[model samples]
Target: MENKIKLLYMLQTLDLKLMDLEEEKGDLPGIVQNLNDQINELQAQIDELRKQINEHTSTREQSNLDAETLNQRVESLKKQLYEVRNNKEYDAITKEIAEAEENIMAKMQNAEEHDDKQKELSANVDELKQKYESLQSELQDNQKDLQEVSKVHEDEELQLKHERDKIARQLPQETLVSYDRIRSAKYGKAVVPITRGACGGCYKTVPPQLNLLLRKNDEILHCENCGRILIAEEIAAEVNKVA
Candidate 1:
């Protein structure tokens, strides 16, 4: 039981050290993450706008071609008017010319509408591209800053995490889960040594009987006030000495 208590304390120690190392990096990690998300969103928007522009351009081109074909047909019909032998034939040729001209006008209008849409989409895409570039530059700078901070603590952090993992593996799964839960609730302090006959974590006075039992270090214990795992002064001394 004493060994278990010591191992838990050791794990807590390593966890605290790792937390401090992470704190040294400041908010660079979060900033880098946010920048990446924004970049991706901007990229998606740019790609979609570009797609719309391409579609509009294709539609305009096809409409212009259709209008040209109808104009050629109208010219052919006009020439056929001269060869008409009767009023009926002359009327039929003129009627064909009128229908072709109407179709040509409709195709031209369709082409102009698509052209306007294409221009508007192109402008929106260009603006999004500029914003994407700016965000990319900012992300690079923040990443560089994060890299600098990480380089300084890389080895130390790795060692501490390795030690923590080793100690945690030696503890029972239930015990480790309890410790982690308490640590999260207590703001990263799961284990504390009894100090001055009081709970070190909450500064609450300890009952005399409970104090006597803590000195035995025979079983794991917790402070009644804060619910943090408690370590006797002697156990803490032993662990610290070994550390």
Candidate 2:
């Protein structure tokens, strides 16, 4: 292999490693965001449950007040019955008393139902609070792990970047520019292999002559269709063996 070709091969290996490291690090932020989202969802559920309990309790309280007032009105009507001036007045009082008694019964039934609903809602809120506490603890633990992973990867990321920069410097400016463009176009995989007369990246067929030229490793070669640098099958097999 020519010296420049060897350098390119070395650069390719380094480039692949750098890509792996960067891709791994990129997912950390998302992991952190997901953890935060889970925590927020749990807290929101707890808050919603508490609000439900509060509304139920308020309804129950209002029902109780109305029932109390209706009872007072029924008592007042019963007292007025003793002072009726005529048959018509007595009949009127009796009707008023019956209506007030019915209103009290209805209010009592509503109060009882409201009490039961409040109890059910309160229990539900308590259960949700317990779950929210557990989720909070879990989120704390996940955040700690995320921080530790970030710290560890920071050093590994710096070393990979340094190595990548060193390899980039060894190539000609024109080659590096071309590599950058291809890396951008090919999703960070600028160098690929030619295997069985096929482009490894795009899986497009290469001519037999081009495949032969790739095997020699005497000059820089690219897949005509994808424009990605192509390594020979022999080199790839050796890499696979070592790996």
Q: What is candidate 2's local distance difference test score?
A: 0.75
> Distance (Å) between predicted and true CA of 90, model 2?
1.5
Candidate 2 clashing pairs, residues 3+ apart or interchain:
none
Q: Rate the local accuracy (lDDT) of all candidates.
A: 0.88, 0.75
Per-residue lDDT over 1-243 for candidate 1, one digit per residue giving the tens place of the 0 to 100 score: 437777888888888888999999999999999999999999888888888888999999999999999999998888888888999999988888889899999999999999999998888888888899899999999999999999999999989888888787788999999999999999899999889888889999888888888776557788999998888878888888887
TM-score of 1: 0.82
State TM-scores per candidate: 0.82, 0.60
Q: Which regions of candidate 2 deviate over 4 angstroms? A: 1-19, 22-35, 158-197, 207-243
RMSD of 2: 7.4
